[model samples]
Target: MALDARHWVAPAWGPPEQWRLVETIVPDPGPGEVTIRVRAAGMNPADRKHVAAPRPGVSLPVPIGYEVSGEIVAIGPDTRIGSGEAEVGVEAIAFRVQGGYATALTLAAEKAFRKPAPLSHAQAANLLLAGTTAAEMLERVHARSGDTLLLHGASGAVGVMVLQLAALRGVRVIGTTSEAGSERVRRFGGIPVAYGAGLAERVRALDLPVRAALDAVGTDEAVDVSLALVADRSRIVTIAAPGRAAEHGFLSIAGSQPASAALRDGIRGELVRLADEGLLTVPLSRTYPLTDAREATRFLAREHPGGKLALIP
Candidate 1:
């Protein structure tokens, strides 16, 4: 039997406004593949930003999502998932998958992992991108026990993950957030400082020497402040400010970088384990019906979402 699914795609290189929801046939899983009935799709800024313009090796009508949590509806022969053998009816989460903004997807089984039991579908869908990014940032700077680390954009998806992971490593985080987000930062064991004028001075007043800095926010202010406090350029890393990173001789990492990609991929299973043990979580701000992807993305662009967002298919 053939399966038809409705998924969002960028029919052309442009903004989210240009994305179209089209119905397409989902082929049966091939060797080493599985078909997932997507319950929720993780939303990330990269989903919209990456497809806004044509990049090398990309094609038109590109899929719009990178991660999803759902159930395995079908499995291919000899397929093995990240956890083990693929089987029908098992709940799973797939990252780096094609056309995740859909009711169904057939993707390589290796990309699928057993969803953590404690995580709701939304949280499972929202993990990995942020979690792995956070892990890499901390790894890049060698964040460790008793180190007082500076984190820009502390209330964001990646920043929140950094806070939690750092706490587990026994590192103390001084997280910069808006006054409105202070409680959230504190809830995750970060010392929340409002980001604005005199930010460096405020951090100095705290009297903790910032050994390493991680910038999830890409603003000039974030770059400038990170440079000011953290003495070792090698110990400062940014996900957003590559230009600043290059000019200042600091580290900048992205999924596009091969080494960073490999690091993130290696750490995925451990992150899932942390979630399974209730040591990590995704704080969700809202969820939208998959058909409302455009509206949801518009909201995400505002950059004020209190937490992660997801799409229910």
Candidate 2:
């Protein structure tokens, strides 16, 4: 017998009204897998897109969430994660294929990792997706020490992580964000440039040319300014706006690909190590209970000006 919880259902794609809650069965762990009792989940911008788009044969009435933090309560065949080892009381962040928002989920051991020590469940909840995305993009683009990297949406969750990591590597990071988020950019080791109205000129006035660019903001302005400032098109990548990236000669980051698993795992391990060592931090805006999943997903779809939202299950 398995337990059940609120699983979100999206019958159609119009607005948030599509979400429906229904009881769903939790499954047992398989080989190399572990069952986690979800303690928290993180909402991402892509979750809203998936709910509205409802890709055919992909997922539906699907419990939507890619990132979650939880404890391992069950271990399965070929289980290296919880074998003869003590109970995994440490919270962990996970990236999943489906049903991440549920009360319990069974997933591969590598898809999850122990949470960074000292981070609350809510703080660690948002790190898996956003933090790993930043790490991968920076690596491929090679934003290095003494090289100027242009980043869009510097105040966002992923944007801030990129800035901090690049800064720690001694890279020259210039960022574009709203006026309200300028101070945050500075605090995260970026030179804040206003995102609109002469945005390109403002960056140029800083007396530095962009060596590479990464777009987290999914805006035309971000692509245009990156093309204007950076010389190498291959050095430009977009985590958002993949549909238009080809036209602008920017690299589309295909995170859904299988290779991303290795890269994401590499980054996750480093971030966890850094956090455990007390060298890194994650910022959160607000947290909602699992019963309020609709509210969390709705807010994640809208413009989040402060930080990432977490769901405590």
Candidate 3:
């Protein structure tokens, strides 16, 4: 049987205004994959950036989402769910999925995990990319118990996850944010410091021996401060400032980097475990209907909301 579904797609590279909602056929799972009826799709900056100006060689009419939470409707050969065989009607969350903006999409079975019982569809949908990114950054920096690290942009989704996960590991963090986000950073067990204008001096004034740093903000100030405070450039990793990494002699773990991919893959299951145990979470900034993806992207670009944005399909 064939399935039909509607999805938002970018037919060409341009602004958010260029995206279109179109009806399309939903394909079944192939080998090592499963088909999911998407309930919620999480949005990220990459969603907008990739659509507006897709990477070289990316095909046209590219699907516009990366993560989704849904119910499994069918399974393909060799697919397994957590060490056992997959079953239909299982609620799950998948990350790095293709065409996640659709009502239904097929995803690699290994990339799909059983949704934690306590998480709502929105939270589960929002977890994977940010959680895995946080995990990878920490791994790149070799963060551990008793260490004090500097985190730039601590109030954002990935930053919040890093703060909480670091706290769980007994690592202390000094997090940079705007005045409005300071309290949120503090609540997540980070020492909140305001960003911009002598930011390096501000972090230095704390008088703590900062062992490592992770830059989520990717500003000139963030890169400068991390370089000044952290003795070893290798221990400083930036998710945002990949292009500037070579100039500063630090490591950059942007999506395409081999180290970044390995780190993300290694920690995928651990992130689920952490969420399942209540050790981590994602704050929802807003939810929009699937039809409002354009509005959602514009809102994210303009508002720079503090938490994750999601679309309900």
> lDDT (CA) for every model shown?
0.94, 0.78, 0.87
Q: Give candidate 2 regions above 4 Å deviation.
A: 82-88, 259-262
Which stretches in model 1 have alpha-carbon errors above 4 Å? none
lDDT (Cα, 0-100) at 297 in candidate 3:
88
| Over 4 Å off, model 3 | 82-84
User: What is the per-residue lDDT of model 3 for residues 1-313, given as tens digits with 9 covering 90 to 100?
Assistant: 4478888889999998999989988778888888889999999888888877758779998988999999999998777954256699999999887778879887788888888777889889999899889888898889999999999999998999999899989999999999989989999999999998888888889998899999998998899888888889989999998888988788888766676777787788888888888878888888899999999989988886878888998
Against the true structure, whose lDDT is highest? 1
- State which candidate, 2 or 3, has the greater lDDT: 3
lDDT of 2 by residue, 4-109 (tens): 6566656667566767667777777777777788888877877777766646577545567787777877767656652133244646667744767667787877
User: Each candidate's TM vs. the true structure?
Assistant: 0.98, 0.92, 0.96
Cα displacement (Å) at residue 196, model 3: 1.9
**Hey, what RMSD does candidate 2 come out at?**
2.3
lDDT of 1 at 119: 89
Q: Total clashing residue pairs per candidate?
A: 0, 0, 0
State the number of backbone clashes in model 3. 0
Expressed as tens digits, the lDDT of each residue in 154-230 for candidate 1 is 99999999999999999999999999899999999999998999999999999999999999999999999999999
**The best candidate in terms of TM-score:** 1
Compute the lDDT for candidate 1.
Answer: 0.94
